[model samples]
Target: MELLKKDNYYHIYNREINSETVFQDANNMSYFLKLVEKYLIPKVNILAYCLLNNHFHFAIEVTADTKDVNQAFSNLFNAYTKAYNKQNSRTGALFERPFKKKTG
Candidate 1:
């Protein structure tokens, strides 16, 4: 994905590792959204979101460019995966690597 330059828009989505459900409950989903708010909201304006049983999506408009925008997203996913794993007694990657993205 591009660095999410200011004023550009992007749609980002990712699925769970294997076919496992990433969001097993409401709290799990809420926590993931919280991670997004905590991490990516600083870098972009969240326009929409879709949280499913095994995958998730986000639409964002970049507010500015600093370092790599992907890092902000990476931080969001990594933080969520860490907490989800600990809470679920699982030990491995949660979302698929290199989450997908598209420009519009």
Candidate 2:
């Protein structure tokens, strides 16, 4: 249960492969925000963030057990992929990785 210990913050991100556009337009950004708003809001406290063309940056505090982060991030990432696929009419992953974590 050591990973469950509530002791650090994490900055996590993933990029589109080959430096492609992740946020093709404003709606993509909007969709990502909505996903974060709905899923990551309760479990994680976001300190800062920036969404660029092909990647995103987030500074967040995990107030509870660290085990919860993967699920929280998965929800956000899945939402993004669904939106991206629907918008772009393509399939497969949007992110290079599903989840990445760091201790802070």
Candidate 3:
């Protein structure tokens, strides 16, 4: 239902649950970016980005190879969340379920 179609442009964003701090420190940001590079850089053409304490945004163009863009993003978020929870000793969801995106 929330597929990111190929050949489309999207503005993507998500926030931590309840506006909780997602990036508690610089390492968290670095890890998230690394995950993004690992999962998303291969699939889409990233135009711009903004990373904050509790949220992040990306403007990207889906490439032909991005057939499973949403899954790739999910992997990125899940990986980040797992590591974050282990690092911070927290539980439950970190980001709000189902990230937001809009074609543009």
Best TM-score among the predictions, by candidate number: 3
Worst 10 residues of 3 by lDDT: 62-71
Candidate 2: tens digits of C-alpha lDDT, residues 1-104: 13423546877677886579999888889879989988888778889998999998888887756667657777788888887888789998888764455667
User: Least accurate stretch of 10 residues (summed lDDT) in model 2?
Assistant: 1-10
Top candidate, metric lDDT: 3
Clash pairs (backbone) in predicted model 1: none
The residue-level lDDT of candidate 2 at 18 comes to 59
TM-score of each: 0.90, 0.85, 0.93
Residue 27's lDDT within candidate 2 is 81
TM-score of 1: 0.90
20-103: candidate 3 lDDT, tens digit per residue: 899988988998999999999888999999999999999999984555777898899899989999988988789998899888
Candidate-wise lDDT, in order: 0.84, 0.78, 0.89
For model 1, the stretches where C-alpha displacement exceeds 4 angstroms are 66-68
lDDT of 1 at 23: 92
Q: Model 2 TM-score?
A: 0.85
